[model samples]
Target: MGTMTPAQRRALYESARFARETTYNGPLGPEYTPAGTRLRLWAPTAEQAAVNLYRKGHDSPCIGTLPLQRGPQGVWSIWLPGDQHGHYYTFTVTVDGVARETGDPYARAGGLNGLRSMIVDLARTAPAGWERDVRPVIPPARRSVWEVSVRDFSQDAASGVRPAWRGKFLAFTQTGTTLHGDGIHPTCLNYLKRLGVGYVQLMPIFDFGSVDEAKPLLRQYNWGYDPTNYNFPEGSYSTDPARGEVRVRECKEMIAALHAAGIGVIMDVVYNHMYRYENVLNNTVPDYFFRQNEDGSLSNGSGCGNEFASERPMARKYMIDSLLYWAQEYHIDGFRFDLMGLYDVDTMNAARAALDALPGGRDILMYGEPWQGGGSQLHRYEANKANLAMLNERIGIFCDDTRDAIKGGCFNAREPGYVEGKPGSFWDVGGAVAAWCRSDRLPPHAPSQIVSYVSAHDNFTLWDKLLCVRYERPEFTASDPVALAQNRLAAGICLTSFGLPFLQAGEEFARTKKGVGNSYHSSPALNRLDWARAGQYHALVDYYRGLLALRAAFPRLGTTDRHAPEALQFFSLEQPLVGWALPAAPGDGAWWRALCVFYNPTDTSRVVPLPAGQWKLLSNGTSSSLWRGESRTYERKALLMPYSATVFGAV
Candidate 1:
């Protein structure tokens, strides 16, 4: 291999961003080439560092070894001759006179079980037409993100995905896959298209430490919150964990397939913490990547062993560079931070600005959990819903107020919410419909900042939460109609509210975890998407789908302007009946001047007085088909059915 001049080395460093790195910010991991592979590592505190290459992914014996020279800014470097692609390598860093072997934290690909880093040929990982793969552009008002996990999408036999492809990256690429091979019932990518959601928020797909990739024979399942390597795709999700390039190729194929189906992808990232405190980051540079208390102990803000020290310049630079890599390489539509509140306001805004500078990233949808699991070491982290204003408008936050207000408290199972006939949650519900603008409660600057959702991966499913109501009321048992009505009511409140609507996978059909509150490590039977349930609860699925279509048709229903909530006027009616009207601009070939909606949670019927005009009924609680249903017009008062929500559009 020809010797790389100093200019070529600097060029390689510039690709990872920062040609002239300072401190710990510099080119990292192994970058492959046709002539040779350039390897670099940032072991600031280590006494010495070297690279060892193995023949196979799981091989223990080293095929060759090379000593790396220490350079400026604590960066270790080495230029290997010949094509070193596909070779499994690890860094041996000597710290305090003790030599330790560890994988690269910035590795874009990993070998089996993610124990070793693999040098990958980036061009070979691309699928056919990957260079020309297209992503759909969806406005925030029209965006509906459906949260899904890779394993849950097709692990069940009834999902109709081919045997080998099931629970793998290729599952998403299998078009025409159906339930029971009936062809009528769409599954996976087809089901996503039929649901009409703009984006799919894939739960943690990064290489994690929980599931053993080498032992796929066992029934090892997890939500994959334990991130071992932040850059590479989870090896277990790939067809073959032994070949690092296979995962890189197949993951892109999954993304390309979804993009072809007109669905954007949102990656669920867990950058707040690592799976273990003594990881690659700490192994190379001890006590630098994680936050430490005054006592010199690691902080547990993430409730995971340690929280990332994102406030540090080098740590923050790593995050931004990783994000840009995903955006440029995989064409990721958006990112959902697992515990966004843990990151300081400055880091988030800077990341947002960096993404915006790239094409199609200006209106990128970025949102996350507005709070953390535990307390942080930093005094003012902007890690909570109360600090929403400190973030950019494009940086969205999950509206826990609306989530708890729609259902009961996420933590408390028995606590009833507005739909469950709770007394005072009505005001919060009102605030949610306007995206909580100009309210005493937490109000993000714009409706775009609020992500309205009733149920997600963390809490109980909407259907089961309604089922929980049965334990308290007794009268509303499993057989009663109250549970179903409350389920629909919860959906209606969330879908019709202002802000982007997000739902969990199979939420339209009321996916349940067998009442398991936290199914992080539950059996596959409890977590897999039950196609039988989807068929059984077809009515609820249809109901949810119709609401999505209604929202899409009427863009005014999703106005992000703060004053849009101010224009909302509530009815004088008290408890049991919550009625409000918002101004709607003329569209859809129908001059809809105003839209009025009524929610009757009580067992008795309620009447809502409407303006003097012909009102076209869109949703009669059950069906909201734009053109098919009985379009009823009301002149005066509309009688809402017991335990149902009614909608009317003024002409």
Candidate 2:
């Protein structure tokens, strides 16, 4: 090995200029065709490249080896004639005379733990009636998203999922599942419909490195944030990890079932950084995939060791291509990017445009965390909170401003937001309602770009966070009047406010993780959605349902542009007391001509003024109903409940 000349360095200028000069997006992984599978890889620096045929997915020796011919654009290709669908393969590339073996970065499916890439027809892996599967259409303003984990979704015995399918992708296919006590109440799929959420943002289902897909899963738990195989469904979520088809087919079955239930599935994808820096993408193109510091070390932007040099042409191509593959192959309704801020603005826009080009792509929701994990040199091309205006519309960014303003700062678990009774800044609350939450919170951009949520998989559940500051007990229960009231208040504020309403799985019933802030590796005891609590706190569940129904009735509540005077008008009131009104459809027969909401986070109740006409009270924080049976009418003023939200519809 010797130092490169300036001419050679100019030819391969920092890998970026060199990559920009070359174009090859035709195909990189194994091409499963009628004539067999043609394996191809891009390794410009490779001295030699070969395909090692393995007998099994794990702990298997190579049965045969086939040398790949160096082709144009540095792509090594080997054409295998005859059936090679079931065969497992790995690329052995010698970079700088040092041999490194790895799986396909573009593999649609993979063997156990993603140690080897599996060759198969992706279409054949789809469940029956997959082609006919129709993704439920949901307007950006009306999508109520619930973040859920595949394992925790049904791992509980109380979930009524059969033992065989308890934690697998097949659990979603189980309909009419019931809890332990009643043996009749809806639990899994039926429970989702009962909850009335349009989309369930599944925690990373792509093959990740944290959990062993081969071993019994009862001993292991993770949120699946560490991705090993970007395209394939997580093997642990499938009935069988050895057979790659099972994971693929079962994942399709889950998506199809969700569609049948009128619920769309949003995949949580970690594209910023993978579990390992020396992964397939790195093994094949060592210095091409990741960003590097001046010392030639990988950048730690993702806080997960290495970040994709996303600005590079080929790297960006792989990301966008993978996103399209999931949309086209698995029929994934939407995508929620993990650590999306690491993605360059151009790359995010490119992905948005590509997804939009699909048949029903407009209905598909696209959103992500617009804040990077740690350090980055990509501030020039950052797709972050400060630069929301620079990105394309329809690509939503998480509203942490509204999140902290309404509930409290996410980083400081013990801090109090408005609902937690800290008398928080109403400006941020107004901004949240505005979908911009406020200018200090963010620029008053398009409503579609704001994803307003209080709790997700990243931190503590809303219940746990509320408990951390209020209670001493570590029990994951939905008890205590003020705590329950506060929980309901948080939901009420987010639902009634602008942007896409999102909550964690079982947050309606105060799903707690025993006060554990980061339960990414916690036991199943803490993660599973306690169905018994749904029965215990049925009233709270009803309140959340009512709010969702009201939101559905007023779709623009989630989609209305911030500061849109025609849609929302603020009622002049005392400081820290936020009140707004939305004019309903013009008609006398309508249940109400206008919808008004007032939020009070104080210990003492206050008389909030109402409009001239007679108004029917819809919710008192605890009960969020649009109907007027339990509550009475008010003309001038209504007593705002203590630490609660009050809703009134003008008659």
Candidate 3:
């Protein structure tokens, strides 16, 4: 690399944007800090750039200023005094005229809606009293994930403290010690330990538009997808939103706590679009950041007001820098991309590279929801699929197969109940499973690339789905407690299945959101976790715990090796029931595990024959019935119970 013309530099930026290196968090190695305070920004078009610090309660508030020298490509940087750590600063770019963007590229804090950004001293207040002395250490590869929202996670009734930990950038960034905060309650962590989960996938915590902006009937529900600043965490979740200082510190504390507990935190990031109202895009070069439609309006590809113009080098750099800041500062374990399909393949590849170069580069996990193009329309994101295959070769995907299989075609659909001798809901999952089973098509990095789940935040509760298809017919409601047992059975399938098991915050005891399908806007009543339900669904919860322990005991269950489709046999002779088996490997001397998954959906007792070998029941709709197999099942009439799913094993 040598010094070149401005045109060549522009081309370099454009070309690098397409290269594999761009997919990663940029400058993965070594901190370039040479002095007390440093400033950096990823601005390409500016001829001159300077840092301006502004403080509260002042007429002429800009206290300190420093000019930045442009480095290679578009990076402009300057070093500051060590004492200037907690300052609020923003960048002023002068190309043809003065234009202010958000915050400094290397700004540790302060970016809230492009008004002002924070200058943080990680040394002074890092959790565990860390002195931020160590060099840059990137993140590690993400293994398992646990999705959680802070608002409904816990309640400190006595102290009158709620989940003060809103999704924030700082919560995932700090390192070297355990974070101390009420947010890291025993309930959430204990659940993580029980599930063998490694990562906590947090929803959006950026300083986004008010909740009122996302009301369902308002024809505008941003879901925090419309990012105002790449750096600021959402302030609404914090206790003191006006200052934003408490939010920053508390978030970092939360991250430190999770890290101390040996659990990783991953933020749900949105880079596809910016806010439609009161944004820098509307103030500055509007077309510079947004994708424009034929009528010169913002394109609505992300279902938000606009989509980012990743085709441009500057915009691409902004996203890369934002993500890198999160990884380096927050120490996040992984990222769950929402609607990643909207971004181009090359751009995503660049992002992957940037992340891959970090300290834990190779280990950092990156996953995404591969949705794309147009409002109310789904596009086949080749980028998303390619990224899934390419990334899973490194990371993994939130597999929709188990979810779709247990439910119907979509995540929101409910199961058609446990009908014997009939095709159950998600039968098509067999095809998806069969596809993954094909070794030739599997990603090369890991044996298991899919993160399987029976329920997620996007759909109705597993319990609600059960009641709809099992207990009620014409009108579906969860008030009837008759179908409660069926709900437990579904949870069993989630825990015992092959892929990673993700339990939505409160599904352990079968929580339902009334009849609301997409309740993103419902009151806390819709989202709150009912601790009492844990007791009611204790049997199911215990059953899940046993299954989790069983899976841990047997690595074979989690094995990614898939059986040959034809060799994978399904027996229909057992009428009113379905039997599937994977014969023992040719040379392997292990006892073959014959699976006879029987479902009696109706209220009738249907008799079915048992499989060969010393028959034992692996599970039979109840926790106590799990793990303990009945040895005497060598009988003629197998009594099938209503809304029951039984797994029989051949010893």
Q: Give the top-scoring candidate (lDDT).
A: 2
For candidate 1, what is the lDDT?
Answer: 0.81
TM-score of 2: 0.95
Estimate every model's Cα lDDT from 0 to 1.
Answer: 0.81, 0.82, 0.53
Q: Pick the candidate with the highest TM-score.
A: 2
Question: If the candidates were sorted by their lDDT against the true structure, best first, what order would they fall in?
Answer: 2, 1, 3
Off by over 4 Å in 2: 1-17, 437-440, 472-478, 560-567, 585-592, 626-633
Error of 2 at 309 (Å): 1.2
TM-score-sorted candidate list, best first: 2, 1, 3
Output the lDDT of residue 307, model 3.
76
| Prediction 3 TM-score vs. true | 0.75
Per-residue C-alpha lDDT of model 2 across residues 234-324, encoded as one tens digit per residue: 9999988998778989999999999999888999998888888778888887756777776566789998898877887888888999999
RMSD to native, candidate 1: 5.6
lDDT of 3 by residue, 506-534 (tens): 66667676756766656654565555555
**In angstroms, how far off is 237's CA in candidate 1?**
0.8
TM-score winner, 1 or 2: 2
